[model samples]
Target: MRRPSTSILFIYGLAITLLAFIYRDPYSLLLISIPNAVAGIYLGYRRAKLIVVLLLLSIWGTFLNAYFLANHGQVVAVLGPLVIREGAVRATAQIGLRLLAIAGAALIFIGGAEPEQIIRDLEAELRLPKTITFSLAYALRLIPLLRRDYSEIMFCRRQRGYRRIAYLPGDIKTLLLPLLSIAYQRAIWAGITVELRGFRKRRPRYRRPRIGLVEALLLSWLALQVVLPIMAGWTM
Candidate 1:
């Protein structure tokens, strides 16, 4: 049998969120947050990591600020706000750690997913409405399509009496209009293609696949994702 795909991992991760809704616990919420951020990193790369780290920092910072507000009672004197105070620093540290944990979790799942697999699973396995599924599939393709169009637009602008100079609005001006126009055209074309491809067709009945060993294991993990957060929150 073929190995379980990246889409499955993402689904597993998403299951965690549903679990969070079912059980509101700060501790479990924090636990779930870590995996979500890590999943983002895993899906992308350095960019994902950067995003997750920033997020963790932000959360930890908030906690630090809370601590300071409760304990230090804000710094105010003849100087009028002496460099934010120690609590501020501590808050920042807390936020940083939370963000790091989130980033780590995102990285784990993102590394395991493939864009193609994700699209296919969303389209077929998930039994999402056809129209929405197709829209998402097209959206996944948009990044590359936009990049290619942008490159072509830039090249054309450069040829048409537009020289790119450092630190100048002229560089952006040369390409922006054409890029916008191309993007609009592409979006229209994609919409038409999807419409013609019967994406809006009536929902077709699908035969569910029997849960295999791997799927069963993944499902179990997902179930745990739901249970753990609430349990953590309750216990904490």
Candidate 2:
């Protein structure tokens, strides 16, 4: 299947995530997520195992936090068709499913997006200013570099006989502080390089994207997902 435009995918993803937040209905959220999940899988996304693990963990954590940890000493209330414990369970399930739906939408949109293409689309279609587009593109491109830098920092720390202590705050201070400093330095260097090259004065050439029937169909499907739920008064 031909993929939809990156911009359309991004907008649709955002819409779905916002819908999930608004509805907060576990059953409806799961149903709505099916198309996005299928689209992601069709686009060659192979993170089902990871997504399943995360979903299970999120459900467990959310359930514990909502029902036991957070509501430990609170009085249970009797709502229509549900008591306080049941309400909490319902809320936990809704939140878990909503999160999974959001993740699925992200996988569908972001997995197929290229930083350069997104920048181009934002600049041309959305009329974003060049500075904003460039900055956004640069930030996206920095993710892998940041990961590599973190790994290198950890290795250096290990080589210097640094051992992780039991205290979480201490560990964060030792590890995260250096990583943040490195990230700051890298950002500054990138700014300096851009300035030196006078990149801001030049207009970037963007590849013009072609939208076809496939894109229209995908967009229509996403629109229906949002509209049908609203029409059916499914927003919980």
Model 2 stretches astray by more than 4 angstroms: 1-3, 41-69, 72-88, 146-185, 202-210
Q: What are the per-residue Cα lDDT tens digits for candidate 1 across 46-66?
A: 423334433543564465455
* The 10-residue segment with the lowest total lDDT in model 2: 44-53
Clashing pairs in 2: none
Best by lDDT: 2
- Global fold similarity of model 2 (TM-score): 0.63
Model 1: what TM-score? 0.51
lDDT of 2 at 119: 75
Backbone clashes, each candidate: 21, 0
CA error at residue 130 for candidate 2, angstroms: 3.7
